[model samples]
Target: MGLVLAAGAGRRLRPYTDTLPKALVPIDATTTVLDLTLANYAEVGITDVAIVVGYAADAIAGRVNDFQDRYGVTLELVPNDKALTWNNAYSLWCARDLLSQGVMLANGDTVHPASVQRTLLDARGEDRQIILALDTEKSLAEEEMKVIWTSENGVRTITKLMDPAEATGEYIGVTLIEPDAAAALTEALKLTWQRDPNLYYEDGYQLLADQGLRIDVAPIGKVDWVEIDNHDDLARAREIVCPS
Candidate 1:
């Protein structure tokens, strides 16, 4: 099972989202951003999916229902209790029970390239969690997460959003986690929630990796993958996912 983070009001994506749920914002003639993402997941045989939503949860559920009616995919709505002052970590907590031992976690705002699905399917039962990493050989900005891999081997540690000056590339917002690591995520959240429930999943991952948990990177860059945050990204991703 995979968990999709769809909670939180699209504050950055204002006015337009004032009336419509951002997830329902269309990216093509017959698809919205969420539609494109969920449809692609279904295309890859991922039938179990939970989308954590907050503001406009009902409307998002309606969209999910519509998708199920049309595409016949299981896109359940998981409501986040605290979506106001939190990042995506809270959404993960809300969708916790929906996930299985090895779960795929993706941002609802991004349409991950279909090629990344192979990395996820291959990650099942792997020792370390897998992350879709951008090639470090490319010329990236100075503020990227420099990769320090052990070898070309399958197991390694991934430090996210590392110092860009010393980093080589970035994360494409696609990840696959092992069962134990998924359980560890819940444990790490229990510790942090005592202090702050608004923490992001990145914090737990970093902590677990620091504690010597292996985190592997699945290389992907050739396909078109875009993340939509502001209006500009929305426009850009629309073109990539639904090029006419």
Candidate 2:
């Protein structure tokens, strides 16, 4: 199954995000961030998709049929009532029921190619429970969700607060959550949101790592992607997806 967390209110990308969720924001004349996402899932043979929606949920709700028809995938809408008040930790946790199926999880705000999803799917194995798509080749910055990982321990730390110099790479908002890791991840996410509603889902990953979970990393070599948090990011996404 493929799961997408689309609940956050992107306050930074106003006017465009004013009436639409970040996922629904148009990246091109005929494609949206969500559209590209579903298309990617379909490309990877994941026909059952669950999207957690909030903050203009109706907009996404209205597009379910269209998305399903266009991508040849089944759409399941998961509602997050706390979307307005809480962060993505809670939003992701809302889809815990679907995680047991071994989910390919992606952040709805991220715009990337199907190859990123294909990379994680290809790297899946019995030993790998939670695999994050890491961009080891990208230039790190303070804004990027940085990860400090070792070949032995996998991911030691993942947070945006860390210094760019210490990070191995940036987590590019795509992950493979195996069935074995679902229970622990659900618990970790619950604890993360309960401790602080403002925490990101990456905090949950940190909690899992702290608890000795073997979180693996798959390097998405030289991929063009962007998480649309603001106008600049949206512009970059446009350039990546619809370069002219």
Candidate 3:
């Protein structure tokens, strides 16, 4: 199964996101970030998907049948009542029940190809419970979610505050959460949101790592992808997905 965190209110995207959630923002004439997401999941044989929705929940909910029919996948919407007040740590926690199924989690605001999902799924193994898709080839920046990982110990840290020079790569907002790691991750996410409502789901990942969970990384090589947080990112995503 697949899980998507699309609950964030993309205040930076302005008028585009004023009535639509970031995931529902149109990247092309007819395709949305959510559309491409479901397409990507369906491409990799993940036909059952759950989306954590907030902000403009009704926008996505109203399109459930349309999306399911268009993407050849089942769409389930998980509502996050705290979406307007809290961060995505709580949004992600709302779908904790689905985590036990071993989910391929994707951030709904990211625009990328199916290959990124393929990369993570290909790296899955019995010993690997949590696998994050890392973009090691991309140049690091202050706002990107950076990670410090060693081949021997897996991911040591994952946070946007880390120095770009000391990071291994950027976590591209896609992760494979094995069923075995679900309980710990769920608990960590609960603790994260309770500790600070503004914390991201990555913070939950950090907690899992701190608890000695084997958090691994899969390099996505070189790819054209964008996290749509603002207008500039939206443009970049449009170029990546629908360049003329």
Candidate 4:
């Protein structure tokens, strides 16, 4: 299953997000972030996708039938009512039951080619119950969700609170959650949200790692991808996807 977290109201990307959710914002002339995401899943031969929607849920819900027909994939909409008040840890927890079947979870606001999913799916296995895509090439920034790993690739930390200098790579917001770790991961997410409703889902991974869950990192080398958080990022995304 391909799971997408698309609940947040992209306040930074406002006026554009004032009408449509961030995922529905266009990158290419005709393709939106969620469009590319669903296409990636289709390219990988994953036909089932579940999208967690809020903050303009109607926009996404209205497009479901068209997206399914266009991509040849089925979509299940998971509503996150607290999306305006709570962070993504809660948005993710809303799909615990669906995630128990194994999933390639991606952020709906991120735009990446099919190769990103292929790389993660290729590296996942029994031992690596949680696999995250890391961009080793990207320079660290305070806002980027950073990651540190052991020599064996076990994720040591994943959060935005870490100093940029201490990070090994930037998590690009895509992950593979194997069924074996789904229950524990769900519990960890719950704990993270309960502690602070403002925490990102990365905190859930940190909690899981602290409890001895081995989250592996898969470096998406030299890939053209962008997370659309603000206008600057949206500009970069257009260049990445519709470059002359």
* Candidate 1 RMSD to the correct structure: 2.9
**lDDT over C-alpha atoms for residue 213 of model 2:** 95
Q: What TM-score would you give candidate 1 relative to the actual structure?
A: 0.85
Q: CA shift at 96, candidate 4, in angstroms?
A: 0.4
Task: Enumerate residue pairs that collide in model 1.
Answer: 142-164, 143-164, 144-164, 146-167, 146-168
**CA error at residue 50 for candidate 4, angstroms:** 0.3
- Evaluated at residue 182, the lDDT of candidate 4 is 86
TM-score of each: 0.85, 0.98, 0.98, 0.97
Candidate 2: deviation at residue 31, Å? 1.0
For residues 20-82, write the lDDT of model 1, one tens digit per residue: 656766677687767766766777777777788887778786666678877668777777767
Model 2 C-alpha lDDT per residue in residues 130-201, reported as the tens digit of each score: 999999998888899999999889899999999999999999999999999999999999999999999999
Error of 2 at 165 (Å): 0.9
lDDT of 3 by residue, 44-163 (tens): 999999999989899999999999999999988899999999998998999999999999999999999999999999998859999999999988989999999988889989999988
Task: By lDDT, rank the candidates, best first.
Answer: 2, 3, 4, 1
Model 4, 185-227: lDDT tens per residue?
A: 8999999999999998899999988888788988999999989
lDDT of 3 at 215: 95
Error (Å) of candidate 1 at residue 59 is: 1.1
- List the candidate 1 regions with Cα displacement exceeding 4 Å: 123-126, 130-139, 142-149, 152-162
Could you report the Cα RMSD, in angstroms, for every candidate shown? Answer: 2.9, 0.7, 0.8, 1.1
